[model samples]
Target: MPRTALFVEIPGVLIAAWAPDLLLPNVGIALRRLRQRNVPVIAVTDHPPVEADEFPDFTERLQRAILEVGGELAGVYAALPDKPASWRKPRPGMLLAAARELEIDLPTSWLVGTDNADAHAAAQAGLAGVVLVEGVDPPTEELGIVVATARDLCDAPRVMIPRQGGCWHDHPQR
Candidate 1:
């Protein structure tokens, strides 16, 4: 049987801001709970090649930063801008790669992101559902379907069922 995994986004989802307190409290709770459940949470991000501040090594560093905040990650993956659409957010490429390399079942996985791009990517990848952190209200017409919504990162774990998968909430609200 193929195992289910949790695919998480970095910037907005994990570290909401770049400051001394980068990780949100609920975000840490979500990561720690998922870790306790033995769910493989792989952090994914896009590498803006033109950005002198961002690089290939940022993913690993982001993972370490998350760990310091009580979020233990299984691994981290990145998609370069120069790569195919599948490699970037709003597309399933990066998620697909992580699923393939990690041996995860797309139809049984979950994604915790802050925008519809994350939701779209999960839907495109055929993931069971998604937990979109509240605050950013992207156009619904532009999004596929937001399986679930979290007021903050902390609500993610409550919405996702690691073993049997999770339920779907078509209507997303703050």
Candidate 2:
């Protein structure tokens, strides 16, 4: 089987809140299961610059939480520095950039995100599938599958068997 890669949007997917200390649920269980199955889980998010004077601790905390969860973050890509102002999600830049940095085959990978636009970006980037979390508006076009929970991604036949006791949360939009 071709190796599977996961491109997750952190702000609204894995974490529930960032301010007043991170309030991440046990989403790590799902990630840990993926890791056990040899699937590479990479976080591709658009966060403020690490050097931002206003929120110096934001990046650090986020990284720490991701690490605690066993996620292999592919480095947060900033649209301001790396690409033109026109580059943003719904555009394939972030996803493509992460794929390149991680040296993964984009066309054979799975992109799971809370936003429907991410599904569009995944399609544009030629990803194998886009797993959209339930409760989000369904994509008008065929992007990929709609999963009820983040753990459902692991249950997909193409991915891995669903493990019990994985954390499930309805992540709020940031």
Top model by lDDT, which number? Answer: 1
Which candidate leads in TM-score?
Answer: 1
How would you encode candidate 1's per-residue C-alpha lDDT over 29-142 as one tens digit per residue? 777777776678887777332243355455556667778766687777767646676787778888888887878777767888877777788888988778877566644663
Clashes of 1: 1
My TM-score estimates for the predictions, one after another, are 0.76, 0.68
TM match of model 2 to true structure: 0.68
| Model 2 misplacement above 4 A | 1-3, 17-23, 47-57, 143-174
lDDT (Cα, 0-100) at 31 in candidate 2: 72
Query: Per-residue lDDT of 16-40 in model 2, one digit per residue for the tens?
Result: 5344245245556667666665667
- The number of clashing residue pairs in each candidate reads 1, 0
In the predicted model 2, the residue pairs found to clash are none
